[model samples]
Structures are given as C-alpha cells and as structure tokens.
Target: MARPIWSGTLSFGLLNIPVSLMSGERRTDISFRMLDARDNTPIRYERVNADSGEEVAWKDIVKAFEYDKGSYVVLEPEDIRSAAPESHDAIEVEAFVQASQIDPRYFEKPYVLVPAKKAEKGYVLLREALSATGRIGIARVVIRTREHLCAVMPHGDALLLLMMRYPQELVDIDEYRIPEGKGADYRITAREQAFSEQLIETMSGDWDPTQYQDEFRERLQQVIRRRMKDKGVVRREDEEPELHENAATNVVDFMSLLQQSIARKRRTPAQASATGSDAPQSDGPAKKAAKKVTAKPAPKASTKAAKAAAEKAAGAASKRASRSDSSPAKPARKAVTKKRGKVA
Candidate 1:
C-alpha cells in the first residue's frame, strides 16, 4: 500500500470525516542532468555570496525579503512561523456549488482521499451524499504549511480531492485582442447552414475511443527504435498542396462535388468484385476476354521426380516409427524377464 502525504479531517456543518490525502499522479519525461563539458561529469551548484564570491554554508544562510532596490530585511524562522496561516488540519467546506457552474480552468493537481482509522462509515456517507446530490464541495485546506482552495468530489466509490486555482491567478479575458461580434453576421446564410447540417449528418457516427489512436506518436517510437538499432532512418517531408491560385476565382460546386463523390464510391465496389475472385466463371464476359489476353501457360514439374521425393519422405517416417515401437517392446521384455528371474 502507498502512504498518504497528508492526514486531516473534512469539516462541513456538524459532520467530520477523518481522511488522508495521497499523491495521485506522476510525470515520466526524458530529462538531462547538468554536466561539465570538459570532464563529462555532473556539475554541482553551491550557494555563494554574490558580492564576496565566497561559498556560504547552509547554517550561515538566512532568509531575506527585499523591500526596495539594494535594500533588504532578514527574517528568522520564528518570525515566518508567526506570520503563517493557522494549520487547522481540516478541510472546511464553505459551499456546495453545482459541478457545471465551476469553470474547468480553475482545476489544478488531484489527490486521492482515503479513510483513516475509524472513519470508514463517515467517509462512505460523504461519498454517497455527494454522488446522490450531484454536487462538489468547495473547501479550503492547509497542506504543507500553505492554505489552498480545493474541491472534494465523489469519483466512483471514493472521494477525489483536487487543488484549485485562486480567482486572482486567472487572467482577464478582456485584455486579449479578440474579434468583436460583427463580421460573423454576414458569413452565415440559411442555405449554407442547411448544407453544413447535411454534411454533419453524413459524417455522424458512434463515439468509439478504441477507434482513435495517436498515429504520430506510434511512428515517432518506431523511428526511435530504428535509430537505437543503428539502422538508416528515412524521414518523409509532408507538405499540404496549394488549394487554389486565387480565392475569388476558386468557387466551390458543392452539389456537383457530392454527385461525383457518390459516383466514385459506386465504381469502387464494381472494381473490387472484378479483381477479387480466382474462379474463371466469377468474371463477366468483358473480364473473361481480358483474362484470356493476360493468361500464361502453367509451369510443368516432372512426375517421376515428385513421386521419388514423396516416397523418400514416407519411407524415412515409417522407419522412424518402427524403430520407436521396437525400442519400447525391448524395455517391456527386459522388465518381464527380470520379474521371472526374481520369482524363480
């Protein structure tokens, strides 16, 4: 079992459920270590005094807060501890908001909530109540000496505690350069909308996750594997062909294109049927005539040579079986003779 990083109680109104928080995720990425180019060895860093250019020991270092340029204030551990927020060891729920009301942008790191000793009943009750109500609990928790806004939501049979971003952390959308709601009115027409709907209907199908795959990632891994094996790798440069010489002159004929596409699809089945069958009778009259034009004489094999090879194989197999059968009989006779000798 994995150990929890945090232990705390969830408090809302009169209810309290003791729970522990376990880290839920890990990142696996290729990384590089800082190394010296001359020696090809790892490089180490040291805290040093910038002005004196002397390395400072850990015990000699003190935390400082810079108030103004070239001016600083040193703070002791006790002073920082006094200014810290109260660690209540509890996740206090402030509100029960609709899950859809919350913007997805505010979500952050996730953690698994596990019931501590003697807290199983309360944990299950909270999980079931949240699942039944279809709402998430907005709460505040102090983890690692820092206060964090969090959401406690039911995921399957257990609770998922997720850290949330503060409202101040979100950037205001109004500051960005975005299109005003004017030009869109002239672009969309009733007929164009109907054609788009028809196109969507033709493409609509069931959502099967198994049908979708990361083809680029698979190809990338193949390339990497080939490189590792010291094989020559060929990289293809793919470029999109130019759509049109000029936008104004290139007008689309939607109905004509659709008709041509349907015709091409119909021709495909006919072409497939013509090439698939091996029997001469399966092809139509025109195909049969073409087949006669392309036909070649069958290659001949000597009947005597084939017969000799088949007889040799059969004889070798028969001899092997006969030897195996006689060897087993010899062992049986030896056993019988030993039994008679003992009896006599």
Candidate 2:
C-alpha cells in the first residue's frame, strides 16, 4: 500500500472527519544527472561559503530572510516554528460554493482524502452531500510548512482535495488582447465557419486518455534500449564519503584533506576506465550464470570500430522510423484528408 503524505482532520462547522491525504498523480519523467563529460563522473553539488569556498555542514546552516540588497535577517528554528499555523493538522472548510464558481485555472495539484479507521460515516456523508448539491467545500490546508487554499469535492467515490491558486496569483483575462467578436468580425464567411464545424464534428470522439501516449518519451525509451543493447552502459560506483551519525562531533583533519583533495586529479572508476567495454554488472546469481554462459567480456574496441557500430545502430533506427511513418493511422487520430474552405 502507498504511504499517506499527511494524516489530518477535516473540519467543517461542528463536524470533524479524520482523514489521510494521498497523492493523486504519478511522476514518470526520465531524470538525468549532471556528469563531468571528460571522465563521465557524476557531478556533486555542495553547500559552500561563497567568500571562503569551503563546504558548510548542514547543522551549521541557518535560515535567513534577505530584507534588502546585501542585508539579511537570520531566523532560528524556534522563530519559524512560532510563525507556523496554530492548527497545522486540520483542513478547515471555510465555505461551500457551487463547483462551477471555481475556475479551472485555480486548480493546481490534487490529493485524494481517505477516511481514517472507523471514520467512513462522515466521509460518505460529505461526498454524497457534495455530489447531490454540486458544491465544493473551500478549505485552508497546511501540507508540510506552507498553507494552501484547496477545494474538497466529490471525485467519483472519494473526496479529492485540489490545491487552488490565490486570487492575486492569477492574471486577469483583460490583460490579453483576445478577439471580442464572433467569426464575422474576423472576416470569416459562413461557408468557412460551416466547413470548420463539419471538420471538427467528423474528427470528434470520446475522451479516452489511454488511447493517447507520450510519443516523445516512448521514442526516447526505444532509442535508449537500442543503445543499451548495442553500446551497453557504464556501471557507476558510489564514491561519496559516509559521515558518522554525529557528524559535528566527529573530529577530523579537514584542512589537510581539503588541500590533498584539491591537489589530486579525479579519474573515472575502474569499471568504466576501459572505453567500449560497458557491460552491465550482474546483480543476481541467475544473471551472473547467464553472463558467464552467453557472453565473454568485450575487448576494448578501436575508435573507428566503435564509430562504425554506432552508425549501424543509427541506420537501423532511421529505417524503423521510416517504416512507422509510412504505416496508416486511425482516421480520427490523424488527419486522413485535408478539407479546404471555399475562398470568398
């Protein structure tokens, strides 16, 4: 089971419903890390003192507000804690309004509200009432440290808490120079409008999101798989120093170590040092046995040989793409025929 992000009470008038907030979205984007291209070593980011260029420990760090140019007001942990909302564990509903009254733009992220143990009665009551009346409860909820304006509404069988943007955060539509009049004002003839409508009507279908896919991501994944199969991947070894639990208390000769580190030239890990031999490390006994039986360790290839192999893979990918492009697509999904409007 997925862990709940927050456990809180949902408050409205005199009623209180104990609930847990669960994330409603999944992140599927491929993440890339910055690396030193010269040696293919992963880059490290550190918190360093700007003036001294010395790394600062996390325990020594303090929050500060920059009130003016080159001026700051340091705030302690106690100071920040004091400023936090008094009832941080409650999603207090201020008012109930018609769902239509809220603009689509105001909705940001969504979180599903799950009823706590033995709290299903109140949860069901709110969801049913919201669904019947077509109303959403405007609530103020504190998730983590920041307070957010949210809407608690009936989403199928559950109550979904959708984070909302503040009024000031939204830009007025009057700021843009949008067309004020109908198609006639833009010199569009009735025949053009009719043709456009006809085109739209012919292409329209049910909104089945599963039918659509992130084409770019899929294509990128295919390319990556092809490259991994042909060129293989470098197995990176972690080299980060493990600090003791009480890092502050652990005494060490830091100045000497810093000087030594600065003087030394960083090199690639042993596994990746030999170019073109990037076979993945076997993690399981079955994989180890398979590696031993099927493939021998690749000998370091010449620069010319590596280039030729890369070119071959590129050519194969290009042919596959060409075949895909020539294949017929569903009429509704792709433009099968172009209908031109009559020139008036």
Candidate 3:
C-alpha cells in the first residue's frame, strides 16, 4: 500500500475522525533535460551569490521575501514553521456551503481523504451527509508548512478534499467586459439558436476523460523511437509501477445526523431553481432541445396515465359521433321529403 502523505484528525463540531490524505491526480507529461548544444551534455544550474559571484551550498541557502526593490526580509525555517496553523494535524471545518455556490475558478487541486482503521463510521457519515445534502465542508488544512483553504466533499465512495484559491487570488469578473445577460445585444435570432441547439444535441455525449490523450507527448515519443531505429539501437521502456483507504466517536449524535441526512430527500426542481443550482437556465430553443436529449425518462406511471387519457378522449369522441348519427329530431326529414316529392 502507498503511504499516506499526511495523517490528521478531521474536526467538525464535537466530532473527530482520523483520516489520511493522498494525492488524487496523476501527471504523465514527458520531461526533457536542458543540454549543451555543442557537446550534447546535460546543463547544470548553480545557486550563486550576486555580489561575490560564487556558488552557494544547499546548507547555506535561506528563504527571503523581497519587500521592496533591492530590499529583502530574510526568514529562517523556524520563523516559517511558527507562522503555520497551531494545529498541524487537524482539518478544522468552519462551515458548510452548497457545492454549487463555489466558483469553478477557485478550485486549485484535488486530494483524497481516507479514514483510518476502525474509523469508517464517522467518515462514511460525513461523506453520506455531504452527498445527500449537496453541500461541502469549508475547512482550513495545514499540509506541510502552509495552511490552505479547502473543501471536503463526497466523491463516489470517498471523501475529496479540494484545495481552493483565496478570494484575493481570483480576478473579479467585473474587471472584464462580459456581455450582458443572454447576449441579447448580439441580436441572436431564434433560427440561429435552434441550429446551435441541434448542433449541441448531435455532439453531446457522456464525459469520458480517457478519450483525450497528450498528442504532443505521443508524437515526440514516436520521433524518439524513429531516431533510435535509425541508429540501430532501440531502448526498451521500463515496466510501469503498480498502483496502490477510518475511526470515530460520538456514535449517537453521528447516527442521528446521518439518519436525518438520509431522510432528507434531494432538492426538488423548484428548490434547485431557487438556489441557482440548476445552472445555465434558459428558455431558448436550444435549451429546450438540449433538455429533450438529456432529460431523464418519465416514470412508468406517468406514461400509463398519458396513454389512458388518450384512450378516454378517443372514446368520448366516438360517443359524440354516435349521438349525432342517431339524433331524435331532424335526422329523417331529408329522406321523408324526398320520398313525398317522388310520389307527387
């Protein structure tokens, strides 16, 4: 099993759950080394003092912050450590918010949280609660020496801790000249909208990340292989390394909260609309078409009801035609008059 990057207690209210943090992303980008053009030798970088122009050792290196031009405030390791959160081994949740409320731009990175042995109850409880409520716990976590703003939310069978950028780190949308609501100023026509919607419907499909590949990396690798073949020496690739999941207290309270969460049904369409969780709301033809393509199947009961109503309407129309054909008055008048005229 892979070792956990950080083992810590996840705190919310009076509950504490022991958890381990692990990386959730894999990077497969090919790397290249800087080389001397003339000799094809790897280039080396040196840390040198600006004043003396002498190389510095790793042991002598210290971090510093430049406050002004040609002015720096030297900080020691201890000083940096002291500035970290008081609790290094805890993820302190401050509040819970609807996950839909978070802007996509603020999400930085994703990490998985695993419950320690025998601590699965609290972990599962939290995950289930978040999943049911469609909310995430906003928390402060100290990973290494830096404190990060993060959100703990449910992802399938696991809890995901997503690092978030601070509000200051995000550029305000108002800074850009975004077109006003629905781009009515653009004078888009209903015909254009219908065509756009049809295009989207034709192109839409379930998201499959594997379909996307790094073409540049693959092409570069092909080139390298070709060069090796030309030289009559091909290098064999090394085998890929094999890939490699808590505890809890407050049983009564946890169970109570969990049961309530489970009992609480998912948000209704009206509620979703009110909360703006049903995003990209529109009444355009394209939006309607998209819904037609993506909407869930109607309930069996609803289908039966519609069929029954159609049959009832047909039966009612047949009864009306029968009544008209056998009317008590004014039905035989034309035949009787024609017979009398023929006799005269």
Candidate 4:
C-alpha cells in the first residue's frame, strides 16, 4: 500500500478540507556503491567527530548553535519543538493571488493533495473556485515539523500543493550586473530590438518534457558497460597461455569453475564480474566461442581476477559519485536562509 507522507487539512478562509500528501515523483538515477579495492567488499560510512575521528551514537549527538567562533549553544529536541510555531493542523491561507504572479524560481518540490472521504465535496469546490478565479491560495503549511510558504491551486482536475521558498531565499538582484544599454556605451538599436523579437519567435516551441533526457547519465553508463566488456576480453586472452600448457588437467577444473560461475550469476546477477571466464571473448561471436572453449578458468585463480575487476568498477563508481556531488540541483533557487534571527 502506498503511504501518506503527510496527513493534514487544507485551509482557506472558514472552509477546511482534510487532505493527505502523497509524493508525485520518484527519482530513478542509477545508484553506485563504494567498495574496498582489495577484496571487493562494500565500504560503510560512519558519522564521527571531526577532531576525534570517533563514531558518535545518535543519542550522543545534540543540536548546537555556533553563535561565535569556537563558541556553541546546545539545545535538546524538546527545546526546538517548543520554540517552533504552533501547529494549527491546517494550511492557513494568508491571501489569494494571481497564480502567475509567483515566480517559477521560487517553487521547490510538489505533492498531490488528495482529499479525505468526507472532504471530497469541499475539495472539489475549492479546486473549482481556484480554477475559476485563476488565483492560487498563498498559504503556510507545516509538514514534517517544517513550515513552508506554499501555493495550492488546481492543476487540471487535481490540486497541486507546490512548496515555495520565501522572498529572502532569492539571490539579491542587486548582486547581478545585467547588461546595460545606456550610459555603459551600448544601446539596442531599432534593428537589434526587432531582430531579437524575430529570433525569439523563431525558437519558441511548446514544452515537451519527454523530448529531454539526462544524456550525461546515459552516456556514462554506456562507458562503464563498454569498459567491463573490454576487461572481459583481456581476462580471456591472459588465461589462453596457461590453458594451452596444461590442456588436459586444466580443462577439467575450468569446466567446473565455469559451471559454478554460471550458477552463481543466476543466484546473484550483480556478482557476475565483467572479467570472468563466462564473459565473451573478442575473437568470435560469444555463443559460437562458448560452445568450443579449449580451456576453463581455474576457480581459485578467478578470485584474484574478481578483485581486479572490482578495482575498475570501484574507480568508475567513485568518479560517478564525484560527478553527482558537483552537479547542480535541478531546482533553480537555493533554500531560503532565515533572517539572522536570534536563537530561541
């Protein structure tokens, strides 16, 4: 069963409609894991004190305010909860404004606001009213103990609650040095202004999200797969020499190892290392070459080979993580920094 991320009531004026918040999006990016290069074991991260390098338990970690250099004020969870704004169990609307007035840059995440059984009629009424007026409810809502300034409006037949950042969150426009056309020694001529409008019209097209994709991610995965296959080819050629020397005895053990590798792969598809004997050789088609293998890879020998493959996989994974960390978030604006308010 799908779970509600938040359960609360939508409020505007005297009317209240019980609503449950459900996430509308699920991220599907390929996730990579960290591994020890030596034995191919996964590496686990620990939250530790920076200076001491000792892992700290959750209970021992306290929220602290760094009021000044080298000074701190610790506060318990209870202290924070008490200081937070009182929860009214409602999204209190401060005003109704033209939906277009809200800049797209201010919007963050979105959730589907589903109505409760008893609140369906009221929900529909509000949805229709908002649609008719073309105005969104500018409201404050508390979700997961955090207050958000949001806009609730009809999106098609559904009500979309778009979380919004405060005005202070936007980078001060004064910081930007916009191109000047007056005293700065440049001016947009009649021809330039007319041509700019013509260019905009030439490029304008309807929004089609399906046409766009994460090409970088797709290309990176392709490279990783290609590298794995190349490593597979190298492994086969390296084993060819040993196979020819002890052709009879080595062949028997090789078959046993090959069978084990196949069975292991069926059990754990992820464990199928790229440079294993089961991998295809470059000399011929994979199916034809597999049918007439002269030698099988030794089981014991494959262990070190697995680790070698792991080292390559781990390196690729590390590079991916580094790229992911540096990639800009899809959202346009940063989280609002609260006015340097006094600590409660």
Output the number of the lDDT-best candidate.
Answer: 3
Ranking by TM-score: 2, 3, 4, 1
Estimate, for each residue in 147-172, the C-alpha lDDT of model 1 and write its tens digit: 89999999998899999999999998
lDDT of 4 by residue, 37-107 (tens): 89989999999999999999998888899999989999888987776679747778889999788789898
The alpha-carbon lDDT assigned to residue 82 of candidate 1 equals 74
What TM-score would candidate 1 get against the native?
0.61
TM-score of 2: 0.64
lDDT of 3 at 302: 56
For residues 1-344, what per-residue lDDT tens digits would candidate 3 score against the true structure?
77888999999999999999999888988888999989989999999999999999999999999999989999999999999878999999999999889899989999999999999999999999988999999999998899999999998999999999999999999999976767356555565555555555655679999999899989889978887779756655788653210022423343343333333333466786676743344224556875676673555655665555555545555676556544432324444454456569
Of 2 and 4, the candidate ranking higher by lDDT: 2
Per-residue lDDT, model 1, residue 33, is 91
Candidate 4 wrong stretches, greater than 4 Å: 50-52, 181-187, 227-344
Q: RMSD for each model, in Å, please?
A: 21.7, 27.6, 25.8, 27.4
lDDT of 3: 0.78
What lDDT score goes with residue 343 in model 4? 20
Candidate 2 RMSD to the correct structure: 27.6
Q: Evaluate residue 145 in candidate 3 and report its C-alpha lDDT on the 0 to 100 scale.
A: 95
